[model samples]
Target: MIKGDSLMFRGRLRGTALWGGSLLLAGCMLNIFLQAASLGMKFGAVADWVARYPALYLAGSLFLFFLLLLFAALVPGGYPGPLLAVAVVVLLGTADNRKLATTGEPLFPWDLMLLKNAGEMRHITRGMLSPLWIAIAAALIVLLLYGMRKLPKVRMRLTWRLLLGGVSAALAGGFLFVVGSGSSLASSLHYENLYWNQKVNYTQNGFLFAFAGNLHQNVMEKPDGYSREAILRIAAKYGGNGSEAANPAPTGGTQAEQDAKMPDILFMMDEAFFDPTRLPGYSFSADPLVFIHGAAKSSPSGYLLSPEFGGNTANVEFEALTGLSMYFLNDGSVPFQQRLVKMSSLPSIVSILKQRGYAALALHPFDDTFYNRNRVYPMLGFDRFTSEKDLPKAARMTPGGYISDLAAVQEAVRELRASKGPAFLHLVTMQNHFPFTSGKNGPNTIAVSGGKEAYRKELETYAQDTKLTDEALAELAKELKELPRRTVAVFWGDHLPALSAGIYAEAGWDAKPRLKHETKLMLLANFDIGAEGTGTLSPAFLGPEVFRRAGLAEPPFYQLLDRVKAELPGLSGSVRIGSGGNEIRKLTPEQEALLSDYRLVEYDLLEGKQYSAKLMF
Candidate 1:
């Protein structure tokens, strides 16, 4: 009644289904085990706390297992029969594909010798899947062997269509191995896979999934007395919020004369202001940042040790505001991007001034909102932020079309003076951002001197922008020099503009000091702060030095930062692999203890738990 070959046909199909189903289930378990092992071995193993994620992890594991089971169980020959011949060959090939995608990395199953204890543990887990899979294949093989014993008798009896279906399913399983692994496995691989995420992502303290509550909490959580008192003692002792809170009221400072009371503060970022190849004592003639260098009460300025190379404006900005260097934490992620911004930074400075009865405003003629600065500034404690939308736009010095840095300065100065009381106005410039292609085709840059002729047109336009900024500062300084309130104006480049790799290559400089030229900071000051000098800094130094010059009390983390500085001696120490002529990436217990001591000190200073510096050591 069911169809042709009734009883014999049904028995054949049932046997095939059972055999195929068992093999399919084994394949799914094999997938999870393989992924986890590869993650551990390749990108430095992840912590073990992750194993506890039952909802997401366990469910995912089961789903994969069952999907494979369903595919096999529905086979024409259900259990230990001809159907198994299709399943065994499929699992073997899928395993090989797993080997291919995880190549180049340490995992690949074959590189088990290189794995550490953690990788070894995971490798074992993956290996467990091996025997189980092998066992499934053996069972299927047995089923196929049994079916073959009767195959000569049955093949003559079964239809051609059923044979075709079995072959097709087996081939599909092999295909999944080849095409469905590695970076190509899924689109979600970029931000999702814990392994690749660590290798390539520049996000949250490495891979977020690596953490499994406290289970994966590797190393010791509190190894010694120093680490036990992380936030309060260490922070206040160093220069943290405890000290931040302990500092005298922001309003207690001695009042300057009317002419000196509310002087303007100007900060400038010279775009592409670097020269690695100096044509040997060429004097490189002309005022690249000369107007600022010569006219300003120059102290001793030098290149800053910075965190970013090609482009990382936020790194510079973070240093400028919080005084906490981004280098203290591991270098993969932005603390602010995470819920990790915890230092006494720009916001605190502005808030202090505001609490002290001052007007605080920040102005950057570019999109002030470009880097979520609107939110960041508010968090940093500014009363107002003026970006390009709020200010009139002017042609930039570079192809990026940023407003002239000078324009931002003039606009800020004019606006702040209209307000009452002491004020903190921060200004960031444009024009010197990038794409150093401005005026390249225009006649305007023809007269510029110094630098390269290849960059002649671009330099001409940039010089004009630089001069404009200088002219504005000169006028402002001249006016403030006699103002009623004693004002402090500070100007420095955010970052030097960088031409493309080709430009440097064409200039025949293979070993130029690219990092040195690109990271220089130009400091020009008027009023009391200007006397601090034009010395170079690692931005880590900028905070302490700036506050010290401003006569403001150091933030809570000051003590710890100072101690850290003594070890590293510059801002770059915190972020770079090298510091104070030493190479140390991960913190030693001794260093962490020392830093934790500072954290505890700052905790005592700020009188709060969250006041801990975001990530230190």
Candidate 2:
């Protein structure tokens, strides 16, 4: 019974069982949490059937989860913990996507409660909803307890061989931790804590968190997506004559005194419209925006350096609200969304306008909650937000609650006319989004409606509606032309429209160049915000330029914008100047330092989830 060989074998078995059980517990817990969380998201709601057969589901899921952990732990030098975490995240995310596709259930992060389709969530992010979790936890506990019982007995017979084994395990653990921390593998370990992770995806960060595409919406998560030059320019915070600083008008006059004299502000941005110079238009059914831009103020738009090109309007919105690009920081976090508590945005121009006796209101036909817009608009200092739910039932026909751009205009006009002060209206149009075809799902009520279907049909109707928007803008101008004070209106694309990747590829193109991610910006109005009726199209200068042109108080940051333009005179005319040296390249040290501050501030706010309503973009 006490043979040396047998006793030695028993001691080794006890040690292996102890750690193995520990690994199993961690694996299952992480696996369940990730899967349940995935399922709990709008994207995974369709996979509720996995829970229908609890016993079978528990058995199958754990077998796979435990097997991987076992392999990882047994491997001589493997990245077990971090890799396991990512695998679970991806596996569960994929599961939800597949189940949703198969079940014909719509799945997306924000679709949880807003969705009216059939069925309900069967699992929650917490383990309680998953019987499999319960099973796995119980099994691991039993194994751990069983291993513990033999632990004391084994120690009673401890020998040199046993001591050596224990030391080896400790060394291995330390080594594993060091290796894991040095590589990108560990970056994703605590990814959930990121401020912007809710919508900014890291789901496809290519085996590690090194890929920033999920955050920058950079194609394939390349480093080129973030321009180091920009981050080093502004000290990571809004500075100089920009709107965030309470600089007396870049020219002069308190906002309050400028009230009766300053014009009302109207703004719009197109989606996914990258610069033609950065991404030329070789073939097109129509150059609709270019045609529309003919009469608008034209300038070389500043380097937007956006995180997303084809989509992610929220990023663009953040840039405009705060007058700083999100390109410089960890694209993994979103300061505008959950982390916005106390974050500072350009002092709400709307709030300042309101103080000057101007009415400030925002209009968007989509669910206001998509970007956590409901939580943010108030923080942005807007008095009211017109979302799709606020629209009549007839207006909710389109996907994404895209009523009609004109409807938003109508609502904006109504609110403006009724408000007690001069009005500042921010209108975000939706009908002309991606898949620019036509359809039943698009807005039936249109000034100019297209009759097609799917995401494309919405786009067709959207372009048609643009003419209406133009006409409406003209009409609004006619109405405000005689207002007591001057009226200033600004319209620009948030980003360019998304064409079929195949079609974009087929149009005598690389079929896979980086341009697919860049978009053009349009800044249009009947009034002259540019002093010479001359300036280029750039996101960086829009706020200050528009403010200065309108003869309103410009912030210090805005003044720097003008200085930037002066240094890079040719920035407005083309993506490339006579030489490679451009404005972005010639940033002054002060500017570079400012970018550092901006990044630092962003990093701090995001790292510490301290949100404050005072920071409005």
Most accurate candidate by lDDT: 1
Clashes of each: 88, 79
Candidate 2 segments whose C-alpha is farther than 4 A from its true place = 1-258, 272-294, 297-307, 341-348, 351-357, 393-401, 440-484, 508-538, 564-617
The per-model lDDT (C-alpha) reads 0.46, 0.45
> What lDDT does candidate 2 reach at residue 581?
34
Give, for candidate 2, the lowest lDDT window spanning 10 residues.
Answer: 119-128
Q: Root-mean-square deviation of each candidate, in angstroms?
A: 15.3, 12.9
Model 1 ranges off by over 4 Å: 1-228, 235-244, 250-266, 269-285, 340-347, 393-400, 438-476, 504-514, 522-525, 528-534, 573-608, 611-617
The alpha-carbon lDDT assigned to residue 199 of candidate 1 equals 31
> How many residue pairs in model 2 have overlapping backbones?
79
- TM-score, one value per model: 0.55, 0.55
Please write out the lDDT profile of model 2 over residues 238-273, one tens digit for every residue: 343222335432234765555556566776654444
Q: How displaced is residue 54 in candidate 2, in Å? A: 32
